[model samples]
Target: MVPLLKRFTVFNLAQCEGLDRLAPEPAPLPERQIIPAAEALIDATGADFRIGGERAFYAPGPDFIQVPPQPAFREQINYYRTCFHELAHWTGHRARLDRDLSGWRGGPAYAREELVAEMGSAFVCAAKGVVPTVRHADYLGSWLDVLREDNRAIFRAASQASKAADFLLAFEGAPEGQPAAARQSHSSVQERIAA
Candidate 1:
């Protein structure tokens, strides 16, 4: 058995050996390339996107997404990240994945849905070759409460998130000159997601 506490030496990286041998971080993709890709994914969903608003949200009733203009974001990637998060919610529409979204804001059900969306966004971002970050750090406390109360909550959320990501990614690479909606049936994707 290992001791609960163990003494260890700590040293600054500047004084470490072979520090100069480390490789430089790869350059991030330009917004021009990344933004269009994200927009294309959004287009594939065929969901009405309304740009120009102080907040970003997906309206299940109207089956539409609304987000602030790109200029409102400090980084362009952040704008797409927000869009992806909202898109995850969009996938839960009754006609789509049919996830329960009746929870009021800040309620337990809402928090659970938020957790799924956050992970879904991260999955989509990773699939699109972008590193994902927590879109809503403010939800940490509620998320912890959710995980603590239910041992299997994380697993369920992760499974749901993977489904959401696959649903969105299925729209990618539609045949040339073919409408995205026509390229793949929503039912088929939903069945796969459910599986």
Candidate 2:
């Protein structure tokens, strides 16, 4: 059986900062490699995405991943990765992993989750037969700056990545272990986070 945590394992390999807190355990979540049911996850989550359109839309739920729209397939993939990243963030919702996206929307909390999801999406893309972005130089400056400010931000990212992975895994009828962090009871990650 494919372990659901590999989604997180891939995030860790991408250097997700915060999950370090959970490292002492032996199983050590799965890595960036494809788990047994990657396709199942794609289907179960109803994660089908459109190729071209406007940048943003109003969705009633906070589980939507917002991507900047464009024409290039490359841009499409970038946004696709970003959308997965946001979906990764939304996975932490109270009904699911219950991550606090609301409190940290535009702040460091939000950025940290973005980083985790960014890495997680890259990992998932690779496993699902797409290429991971190599233009991380574009992200390093801001990411490092954020990391410098929040000592524990990495930990939060790790937890969020695991939560995202759990969310993906749940789609496959996989087991979900409670993430290391306690989720906020009320509010969506979006309502708590950004515009």
Candidate 3:
């Protein structure tokens, strides 16, 4: 007869002699270096950044990004992540990507814009070798409701997000011969939305 093996959802290694040695210890968080590519991309936008506040936001009227100071974050990477998210919103300025930024908080339009920002930030973070996390968990319900209402909502949001990411990334190591306006003119936000 074959010997039986037992499975466990929770196991106590200390219950068995010498089994404690086999238990794995938790790993430490890796030290991540600041991404210069992300920095260059942000600088290229020429968007004003105010870096000392409790909340993070992109003010489209003035075309500025405000983020809490670096020291306020538990992990330095989170600070950059927040900045990238706001920068995604900054791309929607009338002079840039020309997205609809007039949505009020807790509304459908707001949820859609938040989705774009979240995905846009993920794209930029991935390009810069940084992991992305959801910055707006409270919007989860609203996002789901929007998705449930329209089958194509996600596709539109994704297309818009890709455009936003591309716009920001274009600023990184831009060619000296091309002016910023000319670079931004290559894609029309309205045309993309209509597709």
Candidate 4:
């Protein structure tokens, strides 16, 4: 069991303008530290990530994720990256962040959700010292379509992804030098999302 962020936490968006203004970037953690930190965060979510499936998906009703095992991936990092992507979807469960997950596969809403998961996974990987790859690079055309249709699409996706990352990182052992303003901004965004 890991530490949990206070549920229903309140944050102020106006004060978050300085979120990314940390004086100096913190030193990266050793490679060995990354996996364990990711595992801890996944564990903290209380969602089961099963390895028996060939396709990866988040089951909102069950509050669980299914991903293919390590051998199914081209690299070890990919396995966990996919896991985090699915975990981002897990955050959208009704009891968690409560995002709308009713879109059909390959639909506009699906592409939007994919954007959130990819960005959220990148944020989590960066937090844990893992360099993230564009796992869903094939989705770029669809993503661009969405962005073209709405100027604020990327902004909303990034904001939602940040909130998903913050929600999971709340279980990590330490804060990893993330600015309080940034964390608070993420919380504020989460509050907005839930509303």
Candidate 5:
């Protein structure tokens, strides 16, 4: 048995910002509709994606991405984030963009590649109307180390990320109400942003 507190704890509700009232939950999309949109987006890139029990990864040998089953993520969005990250790596496969994917972990090359993948993921998320969040905040130190080592490192990574995003989104066809010239100009603006 445990002793009970003599007084009840209290919080000053007025001081609590944004919690005065409960916000309504978003209307949930059907699972079948949700999964296929992302799946089709991935499939459109011509890369094989599979569900696995292990940690997610992009296997270069067979050019496929292995993601843990949907249940592995706390939220549906997280699974897609992981998928986009791995798919960014998939863009580096020899038959694709051909990046130097042979780097060992903890090496400078590995750090650079990780930077590319992360930025690429962010770009893809933004394109797909998903707000980007830092999925691997722990890797910030490694990324900072890489950036400190090379002045142009971030530029190159951003350019590659933009290209990876463009490559993936291209399969979705044109954006509604946007003309081809506008799209091309937007890409040019993105390239300027890299500079």
Candidate 6:
């Protein structure tokens, strides 16, 4: 009984920590949406997760997601679940996907974060070879509530999460929205940003 109780407590605390990682703040704008173009792997698998058109987010947890092995990750696939979860969060960083980590992340903020991460995970799982685990139904109610409360939450979170997903799929050497030819054009964009 003691061991079980301790495990339960630990799980709850860890979940709280995960939620805190994406603390919200007020911003000048609602943040920009990041979208990746379709690729061969995306086409072959028939699993392109469209944002703006619908909702999106990453699902964390081992479960054998498929991707080429690289220096960042030891093996071809990761067994640790939370790592993927965080990687999913990291994808929303300003430099990569430019996801808004600020103000009222749509309601509980935490709930919106979870929704995006879960959606991203599910899509990546299909690409990498992991099975989609059971998503919590309890959150569905909260998610809907948040969406209803904030119409833009669904759109922003989905857009940001999609870009994050594309950023994480860097091993494929594919820049989400950056076309091979557009790299030069974006050079000016980058310069403007730098200025």
- What's the TM-score of every candidate structure? 0.73, 0.52, 0.69, 0.67, 0.66, 0.41
Say which prediction, candidate 3 or candidate 5, comes out ahead on TM-score: 3
Model 3, runs deviating above 4 Å: 1-33, 132-142, 175-195
Two-way lDDT contest, 3 vs 4, winner: 3
Span of 10 residues, lowest total lDDT, candidate 6:
46-55
Full-model lDDT, candidate 6 = 0.45
Candidate that would win on lDDT: 1
Model 5 gets an lDDT of 0.70
Name the lDDT of candidate 2.
0.51
Q: Please, what are the lDDT tens digits per residue for candidate 2 over residues 122-141? A: 55655455553545435634
Q: How accurate is candidate 4 locally (lDDT)?
A: 0.71
Best by TM-score: 1
Model 6, 1-195: lDDT tens per residue? Answer: 565565433455445755764666654433322113323334222222322211223322221224322222323133222234445554555544445445324446666776666556555655555432444344445576756768777776665555545544443443444434332333444444356
Predicted candidate 5 versus true structure: per-residue lDDT over 1-195, tens digit per residue: 458847767878666779846656666544522555665576556557788766888887878889987665556676777888898898787655678889836677787888888888877776676653445545545586766968888788877877777666765664443434233544554465457
* TM-score leaderboard ranking: 1, 3, 4, 5, 2, 6
TM-score of 3: 0.69
Could you tell me how far off, in angstroms, the CA of residue 188 lies in candidate 5 after the best superposition? 14
User: Distance from true position, residue 68, model 1, in Å?
Assistant: 0.3
| Model 6, C-alpha of 117: deviation from truth (Å) | 1.8
Model 4 C-alpha lDDT per residue in residues 22-84, reported as the tens digit of each score = 545775433332477676666655567787767888877767789876565546677677778
Please give the lDDT score at residue 95 for candidate 3: 78
Which is superior by lDDT, 1 or 2?
1
Error of 5 at 161 (Å): 0.8
Task: List where candidate 6 sits over 4 angstroms from the true fold.
Answer: 1-81, 103-107, 136-141, 174-195
Q: By TM-score, is 1 or 5 better?
A: 1
**Model 4 residue 156 CA deviation in Å:** 0.6
Count of backbone collisions within predicted model 2: 14
TM-score attained by model 4: 0.67
